[model samples]
Target chain A: MTGVAGVVLQVLLVAVGSPLLVGVMRQVRARLEGRAGAGLWQPWRDLRKLMRKQAITPAGTGWVFRAAPMVLAGTALVVAAVVPLVTTESPLDGVADLFAVTALLALGSVALALAGLDTGTAFGGMGASREVTVLALVEPTILVSVFALSIPAGSTNLGELVAAAEANWLSLLSPVTLLAAVALAIVSIAESGRIPVDNPATHLELTMIHEAMILEYAGPDLALIEWASAMRLTLLLGLLAGLFAPWGIATAGAGALGLLVAAIVVVVKVTVLGVALAAGEVFMAKLRLFRIPELLAGSFLMALLAVAASYFLV
Target chain B: MPDLTYTELLYLACGAFLLTGVMVLWRRDLRAVIRLFALQGLALAAVIGVLAAHQGDLELALVGIGVGALRAGLLPYLMARALAAGGEDRETRPLVNVSASLVVAAALAMLAYAISRPLTELAPSPATRAVPVALTVLLVGFFVLVTRRRALSQVVGFLLMDNAITATAFLTTSGVPLVVELGVSLDVLLAILVLYVLTNRIRASFGGTDLDELRELHD
Candidate 1:
């Protein structure tokens, strides 16, 4: 019963809070750049407007284009429920394995990438190709870095991994933790289309990676993609906080009050991470497209080192 | 500060040591390479400090500080001076590209792990277990030396290999005699001074310090 309640709470929190997170990040970036920024409710307002507008489909697009937003939003919601953000006692514990969660996230990305290709626009194809290229390099690091954590935990389940971290807090000081943290941080930035990889603020087609794919999206479809993207970013940051700094998260047998407190703590953690990321973005310019691989490759090396250190240093 | 045991801290330092070596290969800027080499030196000092603290050896601790000063401070300072004189900042051409160099580095690290298995199996202490990291740094430094075209980068490579040797000595046996370590440190300093002068002479004569240009003299 508690597990079920926790899952419901997580889904609701992500659904409502993710847009606010996006708004807060944008507001932070704006403030740092010395501008009068939109309030934190701006994303919610934009979503409201987009939701009321009529949907439009570009010519020659088929089912892939129409269904992509649903797939992406659906996957993000599922990942939100499964990952141990607010509580470790998720109802979907069996599906909360590291590989399952990663694949679910990749499924959303693939759905969006295919939709981009289906639009038959040059920018869409270019964006799809680039996203897939980054994704191919990114997935391994994500898998291997978390695999480093899972090694000592003795399970690949996300809940179990977090539980292990909580159990032996000293493990956080291990070289494995440090290496994996750096690796996962890099991949998270890449996955979320943040600056130094892709500029989320950029609408210029030449430099666009995430934005290029969705230029043709309109009305509620665009809103869904935008909301799903925010949720995805929220989830990645939340996962990083939960896995590495699993201090406040509610564990198995935690009561409803514990679950509520955990929710607040995770919200705070993810918000802090989001603000830091945005502030970091203010100081960074996007890497040239060619140099981006070098960055990802470096992260991959860190992840590999994390895995090796976890094994050999033990 | 979580309560990391001595062995865990030692492992962390060694990890940083090896990571700096790989980063040296990843970066194309000569100044960044020098910076990473300095960082590697600091990591070496960390390895020695951790071991010294674990063993309660004052001599080793003092040696760690001296090595840190020489390798991290004095050596990189001298190298940066050469870099400033040369006026070229990037290692634009190398025998191997960045991606390939990184791949080779990974392979060398794995090889180090494989070959160090017996050595670790023999003693099987935490310090002995971490010898492979030093070995990896040694091989990577050598890789940098052989593959890099610039004299300054080669000097970094030489210093990295030297740092790794120092790390190995500290990790396995705790410390060598203080006099022996100091003698080696002074020798390395003098060697770098010589190389620094050579780099400047080469740059003046050839208008650049690309070692490949030295081959033109054969014709």
Candidate 2:
């Protein structure tokens, strides 16, 4: 019963709260840049406005374009339900394997990229290609770094990994943990279309990787993509916090009160991470497209080192 | 602040040391390279300090402080001074590009782990376990020396190798004698002073400190 409630709570929290996470990040960046920005509810307001408008499909586009947003949002929702965000007793624990979660995320990305290519616009195809390039480099780092983390826990199941971390907090200070944290942090930045990888705020034709793909998206479709993206950012940040700092997360035997407290704690953790990421973005410029591969490679190296350290240093 | 054991803390320091070494290869700016070298030095000192605390050896603690001061403080300051005088702040083009250098660094790290297995097997303790990281730093430093074109970068590479040697000595044997460690630090200081002068001379003669320009004198 608690497992069921945890999934529903996680899904609701991610669905309702991720937009505010995006809003908080924007506000933080705005304040840092000395702009009196929109309030924390702006993303929610934008979503509301986007939903009321008529959805548009471009001429000659097929089901891929029509279906991509739903696919993206659906995958994110499933990930939210399964990722052990508020509690380790996720009902979908069997599907919460690290590889399964990563592939689920990748499936969303591939859906969007195909949609981008289906649009047949030059920018759409270009953005699709670029996104795939980044995804290719990022997936390995994510897998390997988490693989390093899993070495200590002896399980690839997300729930078990967090449970192990909660049991032995000392492992968080190990070199392998630290290295994987740094590597995963870098890849998360890249995977989420953040600055120094892809500039989320930019819509300039040449510099945009993510924005170009969504250029043809409008109305409800655009809102789904935006909401899904915010959810993904929240999910990744929440997962990092859960994996590295599992404090306040509920264990298997927890009751209803424990689940509620865990939900609040996860919101706090993800919010803090989001704000920090936003503040960090204020100081960084987007890397050149060619240079981004180098950054990703550097992260991959760290992930590789993390795995090596986990084995040899054990 | 966490209740980390001595071995875990040492591993963290060694990881920081190895990371800084690889970052030196990734960064193009000479100043950033020097900063990373200083960070590596600090990490090396940390490795010593952890060992000192683990063993409760006052002498090792003192050596750690001296190493931190000399390597992290004075050496980087001197290198930065040379950098300001030389005016070429970037390694515009190395023999290898940044991505390739990073991949090579990963390969070297793997190689270090493979080769250090026998050492670790000979005596399976935490300290011996971390030897491969120091060895990785050593190989990466040598790779930097061989591949980088700028004389200042080469100096950073040499210091990286020196730092790795110091780290290995401390990790494998707890530490060397205080007097020998001090003498080694002084020798490094002297070497830096000589290199400092030589770098300035190269800048004066060639209007830049790029070593490739010196090939004209080979004839």
Residue-level lDDT tens digits of model 1 in A181-220: 9989999999999999999888689889899899899999
Interface DockQ of candidate 1: 0.64
Q: What is the overall TM-score of model 1 with all chains considered together?
A: 0.97
lDDT of 1 at B136: 86
Model 1 misplacement above 4 A: B1-4, B177-180, B217-219
Window of ten residues with lowest summed lDDT in model 2 chain A: A201-210
Candidate 2 yields a Cα-based lDDT of 0.92
As a TM-score, model 2 comes out at 0.96
| Candidates' C-alpha lDDT | 0.90, 0.92
| Predicted candidate 1 versus true structure: per-residue lDDT over B21-42, tens digit per residue | 8899999999999999989889
Specify the poorest-scoring 10-residue window by lDDT in model 1 chain B.
B1-10
Question: CAPRI verdict on model 2?
Answer: medium
